[model samples]
Target: MSVTAVGAFTDEQLELRKTVRALLAKHADPAAVRKAAESERGYDAALWELLCQQVGVAALAIPEEFGGIGATAVETHVVFEELGRTLAPTPMLGSVVLAAQAILASGDTDACERLLPGIAEGTSVAALCWTGAEGSWDTDNVGVTAQGDVLTGSSHFVLDGSYADVLVVAAAVDGVVALFEVDPAQDAVTRRRVPTMDPTRTLAVVEFAGATGRLLTSDGAAALERVREIACVALSAEQVGAAEQALANTVEYSKSRVQFGRPIGSFQALKHRMADLYFLVETARSASYAAVASLAEASESAASDAAVAKVYCSEALQSVTGDSIQLHGGIAITWEHDAQLFFKRAHGSAQLFGQPRAYLTSMKSAAGLTA
Candidate 1:
């Protein structure tokens, strides 16, 4: 379906999606994707400029007073959905999901003012340094330590950590959680890039030994709850986009590809499968939108809503992507096929806010289920 066919969004958002999709098509074509994935940096610098500096996608969520487009999370979701559709190689997830969110939610206006403009302008790259092993977003799980002005220990599975100029990291010290900024140029910090299931988005292990950092938030524990809320909702929205794209691709391919002298989509079996996937994607979208709406109200039920959306969307993306590849046949598994990219994105994103199993546990708890 064309982007405009999505009825929930505004005309401006539709135009924005169309423009960015075209930009990605021209700048991040197959060869460009291959080069970015194979290169040491894991993304195209020139294309980054075109999107962030010229196109203004990175600034979408930043307040206009701080050199941004002053967009809400819903608008940001639209931008990311198109990026996912094109599988564009950019740090949108890392920057917005991790760094920008941490800074914005930290309640450190000075820090936000100082850092966000550079991020919006594409002059700087920042990543949130946290371990996937931290599992859910509880601050008590933070293993990295910070004392005085120094931070120690390593953060594992850090998204875009290897490439970020600034690292907004979570750490614990004296039983208090804190957010610290680690400068990558400092010798006390070391980064090792890890090969990720999704090559389009870079991941790394960041080691800090007496790394000098500026503290941003003193109440890391409280801030963590808020940060996780934002991450979960934002991720849920991204999944909505990914799920939509996968279903659309699957349906489009099924309609065109022929077998036994007729379109395979005409087969009852495939039709049933596509129908199931469509239901899953639509349900996920509703859950995601509800969560986003709840977040805007700062509703006390935001955590539960976010959890529901996360779990639902995560499973939906996984199922939809699986069906997408299956429907596309063997061609989907090929490295050259866009289906593989969507597959990787599904796996990578599914685990970002804890796996579906973990969220399911949270969901059960939300439903008053006993441990």
Candidate 2:
């Protein structure tokens, strides 16, 4: 069945999906992906610019008034899925989806007007630093403290933080958790590139040594919760794509490789494994699509939908990628193989927004179920 039929995608959205896939096929081929993975920015600079400028992907979900395409969450998910399929590295998720949405939710019109236009134009990158030591979407653990317009303390596991033009930090202000926007170039703001499980994506240690900030929202704790929910949905969409690609590659390898004068795919064991992976992929797709629909409608149950999507999709992708390597027997672990890339990406992404169990717990709470 067509994705549109299953996910309620419009005709335009289906076309958008095709266009995104074609673009990735041209620019994000395996060689380019490997080169980008080793590069300093962790992505093809030219491809990133092309996607942002020519394809206008960075502006997909932003409002038209803020120099965006004024698209919906469905379109955003479609773009992310294509990115994931190729394992393309970019700041669309960090700058556009998470940080831009946080700005809009902040009720700070001036911040939106000034910052969001640059984000839509692809000239600026932003990272939202919400998690601290605990690394689980908890506001109480946010170590940064805001003293008037100055921010102090440090945050870890900040995604895309090393290259961001703007930093939106979740900090405590006068005992209330709030969102603070800071310029990363400032002397007081230090960004140290941190080792990550996936070098295709970058993380940083951000230290605010009395760094000056512009308050984005007084109710930052709530805004960050919304950002976490939005991020979970986006991350899940990517996981779904990655998992789909892993299964496809594994199946193709099984069909091509020969053993005892027959294709390895003929083995009953391999067939059973592929069937199980297919089921997981489909389940993840359903949950992720449901989250996208809920987010598009701004539904009251969107949080629960996002939690379920994260838990199911992350686990599914992790499992798919792990088996993808095993399905290849040994070649999958070699330096030249692309399967390892997907495996590393899946491993890192599984813990990106929140781990599977954390989201599962949230889902239960949202559903009023006992732990």
Candidate 3:
């Protein structure tokens, strides 16, 4: 199904998409992007400000009462799609969508009041530190232990961990898994950047040695689960945008590059492959929109829909990005080629939130079937 068939985007959302694309076109071009990647922060501060202040992309889904645009999931879908299309480097995924959603879904007004405004205004960067060494989302996999208001243990690969001003961690308190808020600068807190396959996104390992923790909720397992589902949907939307662009670039390159006195794309085999990729892209797009719609309606199948979208997008992106490199041939293997960047992001994003296999299991569990 096409996006229009479902009426997924409001007129306002479409306007937002155009505005964000225009802004990214100006700021996120290849040369400018390479400069940002080499910077210490791994992103452009000025461009991030433009996105948060002028575009209000960070605040789109945040409620106005808490200093945001108070938009819906559909708006988020459009914004995420634009972000992925350009591979725009920003912390919106870690700060606004994932961690902020965890707080909001917990129904903790106090936490939102204290933490959300900074996120909405783009001043504070937050990340959720949930999975540990094992990289499992199951509550039982939580390695951090919270006793009273102090937390102990270590978390690995926390999103935006190296740059996060505030960290929302899932820790067991009183033998119940709960969400705890921590200040990264606390004396007992230790954080270091962990090398990542994709430098566009930062990750860090943080250890708490009896660090002070403020409990967001005594029972936040469900809230984290909900955030995980919605986050996968958001990332899937991004994967679609990125994959779509990769395919477009390949097609353009094929038309211009000649081989054997003919354009490579003119060949039957290459044309057939590109056709398959287009079909994959469209399937992913449909699944992404369906997931967004289900979540927006608060439907019973939201989890299942998100799972399906996440799994399909992950697999599609792998094929799309790999084929992008294959079609580009030798030039693509060079470090400076944009194809390498998309391929790297594809591999990185495939495992974000959870892998396709994990989401497949979630789909089964959601459907009351044995995984």
Candidate 4:
């Protein structure tokens, strides 16, 4: 798809993006972000409330019947982009996007009725436990096993797992994958927050030992695949936003930091590097927009589009953030600089969901191309 076709945002979307950016600017400055990341809950509760209550961000993709805005993935992408721009530590990804979408995709109306409203209002955080210790997020890598209605095993790298009110689990049942809903407060569930390189985000390891679960879907492989595609698209948007912000910050720094009695950005070598970084950011935006548009339309090519976006955006963000650190000089290495955080986020996000090489391999296999 052409960039013009997919990159054009509706007026309402532009306004939504503006409002979110303004809110983050006022409440999620670097200091506040650092504090929130260090908080027990790993996020700014007040800021999250404002985003959900005022902006209805968490409800954007839920159906109207479920107390949501009844919008499409495009709106979710918009919100995620803004969140990524600031590296805001919110559960929107884990609760609102991944787990919430997993539930919706299950075709379990009762589950939706019983659980969605709280998620829509951002009062209840949901964690999707799927990946194993390897963190591949693949169907074969599912960590949990279900015996009848009881779940056992451990899921690693679960976003917000430690404090989530609800758990949406993917487990193997009779050699088939299924989705289950379990209360995190259950006696059989144990969640431990894990240390990660990216302080701006939190992950947990959740272990279940015969925890009784409400089955959401017996045939969950299809739903899990769909959720992964949607997640890839959503995450591509985040990567694009973060890359743009990282490049912007680096450019701004280059304009002020002087060397040889002139701004470093005035140097031809640095100028070329910044220009190249700008290209990566723009191209990543195009790829993300294309994937979002395809997903919004339910296009047949959506899966491939998501894979492409995931690969391209992940690399772009890594490149931009790495260059950002270099452009900012030694100051970027210090804790006082936001460049370090962005760099860490870039590397962390690249590994989230799945790595770029994994996606590339999948894409090749999908095309029946022998490596």
**Which candidate tops lDDT?**
4
Better of 2 and 4 by TM-score: 4
User: For model 4, how does the per-residue alpha-carbon lDDT over 317-369 read when each residue is reduced to its tens digit?
Assistant: 99999988888888999998899999999999999888999989988898898
Task: Give all TM-scores, in the order shown.
Answer: 0.91, 0.96, 0.96, 0.98
Error of 1 at 291 (Å): 2.1
Put the candidates in lDDT order, highest first.
4, 2, 3, 1
Candidate 3 least-lDDT 10 residues: 1-10
Cα miss at 248, model 3 (Å)? 0.5
Measured with C-alpha atoms, the lDDT of residue 181 in candidate 2 is 85
Candidate 2 ranges beyond 4 A from true positions? 1-5
Superposed Cα deviation of residue 148, candidate 2 (Å)? 1.2
Model 4 spans > 4 angstroms off:
1-6
Q: In candidate 4, residue 79 scores what lDDT?
A: 87
206-288 in candidate 3: lDDT tens per residue?
89999998888877788888898889889989999999999999999999999999999999999999999999999999989
Clashing pairs in 4: none
lDDT of 2 at 126: 88
Off by over 4 Å in 1: 1-7, 132-137
